[model samples]
Target: MTVTASARAASPLLDLVRPARPTHVVDVGANPIDGDPPYRGMLAAGLCRVTGFEPQPDALDELKRRKGPHETYLPDALGDGGTHTLHVAATSGMTSLFRPDTNRLGLFNGFSEWGRVREEVQISTRRLDDVEEVDAFDLLKIDIQGAELMVFEGGRRKLAEAVAVHTEVSFVPLYENQPVFGDVDQELRGQGFIPHAFAAVKRWPIAPVVFGGDFRQARHQLLEADVVYVRDFGHPESMTDEQLKQLALVAHHVYDSTDLAYHCLSQLSLRGLAVPDAPNRFLAVLGSANRT
Candidate 1:
């Protein structure tokens, strides 16, 4: 599942239409356990720079060891800048600030074993706004198990300038007092971000029920998913020309949302802000990529 930048088709149009500066990305809870990130293509093309935060010692070590020149990794646990207990689970990916809800996890198969608490470590968190290393960024990608709301509440100032957000949203709360999808969605909307798409949708089968000889196969229970949100594209007049261009680059390079990228370019073109025929050139490049 390690997707490299080479997997994507080459497009010279991206080179011509990319922003003057590299897109800045801030990644919270950046554990490589999830495989390659969505911005891998941009990173490989030298079109973006990443600043990642990981609290776990082993995970932080791995990130630093393999980081690129433009990539920076910090060992800061990000939240509302308060002290909290980190519930280390049997599986690293399951570790979270909030304790696991064993009763609820038992309702689904495989999760109970994965979410079992192995240890608890007291730690201090740093608010995103307080981090001096992160001055400003164009995109934010966060996945901190269940404490996503705390970051949003404390990082409003930093998030205001971001063009897009890629965050993990839970349909069902696996941790005690965890905020679900609706909670995160409302907060992002209040911050002027609109839901764009769901990059991943995870489902788990109910316990003690086997479906078609596959015990791990899910029948109809939604667990969690990675959701992408972007600043209101419908009102291009409200956004700056730089914001529009950055959004187009993010949409095309990160999410492969060609239509959305084209719409962004189209708005810039109408205002005489973009290069001549930028939208059409984008479509042509996409068409050629698809054919190859």
Candidate 2:
């Protein structure tokens, strides 16, 4: 469920941890092919600001057309600051820097058709650190198909201050030379983040076979997922007070992980950084929300 202003208002715990400025979010591959983003609630509630990058012309136009006051959309391809050929797939969401691996995709249902390259465009890319408009942000939400590692490699300095990251990790390589989940995990962990939870998981059945007459339903074969990671929460001493506050807000508002939010509050209280009853009030707020 998208967390609304009423939800934020009801949570006295959120009030205690709310930062002076809105949470800043940097979205790479900000195409609207998918429905509302995970941070939609925070965006609607005026609790966050979004700076989105989409190189696809049609996608960029759509984003600009519906952009809100707190949103900024840019038409820049983000990578390792080098020119590369973008494989524009039949499905916009499938488009990526790497070409589709037809052999692997043919093994699954409906993927080969969708991953077919409709066009190939050569584009110059910008590194995240080189972008003058992009500064320190609280959250990083990226889904650039198979090129996520390029962003991470080029933006280490920019990501140092980030409190949380929501990224699409693939268990199976859908694109040629794609870095799978393990690769992304190692990089994120090196940057001081621990895997928190998966927001969504996708599965696909093998081609020429249907499960109970349903092609969409798969009993096994995990394909991809949107994984949420946060700055190492176990060590409160490593995070600043502001980082704790931002993380608490993202946990509660974006991911609905109230326990994680409460943990942040408890750590704050331990350091005399928050009210003594902050954690208790958070539980009370959660209880009230559940009842209603």
lDDT of each: 0.87, 0.89
Q: Write down the TM-score of every candidate.
A: 0.93, 0.94
lDDT of 2 by residue, 1-292 (tens): 2335775674455577756566899999998677899999888877778999999999999899999888999999999999999999999999999999999889888888999999999999999989999877999999999899899889999888899999999999988899999999999999999999999999989787998888778978899999999999988889988889899998988999988999999998888888899999888877887799
Error of 1 at 276 (Å): 3.7
Sequence-dependent TM-score of model 2: 0.94
Report lDDT (Cα) of residue 184, candidate 2: 96
- Highest TM-score: give the candidate number: 2
Local error of candidate 2 at residue 187 (angstroms): 0.4
lDDT of 2: 0.89
Give one digit per residue, the lDDT tens place, for model 1 in 163-280: 9999999999999999999999999999989999999998888888988888789967999999999999878778877788789889988998988888988887887777778888
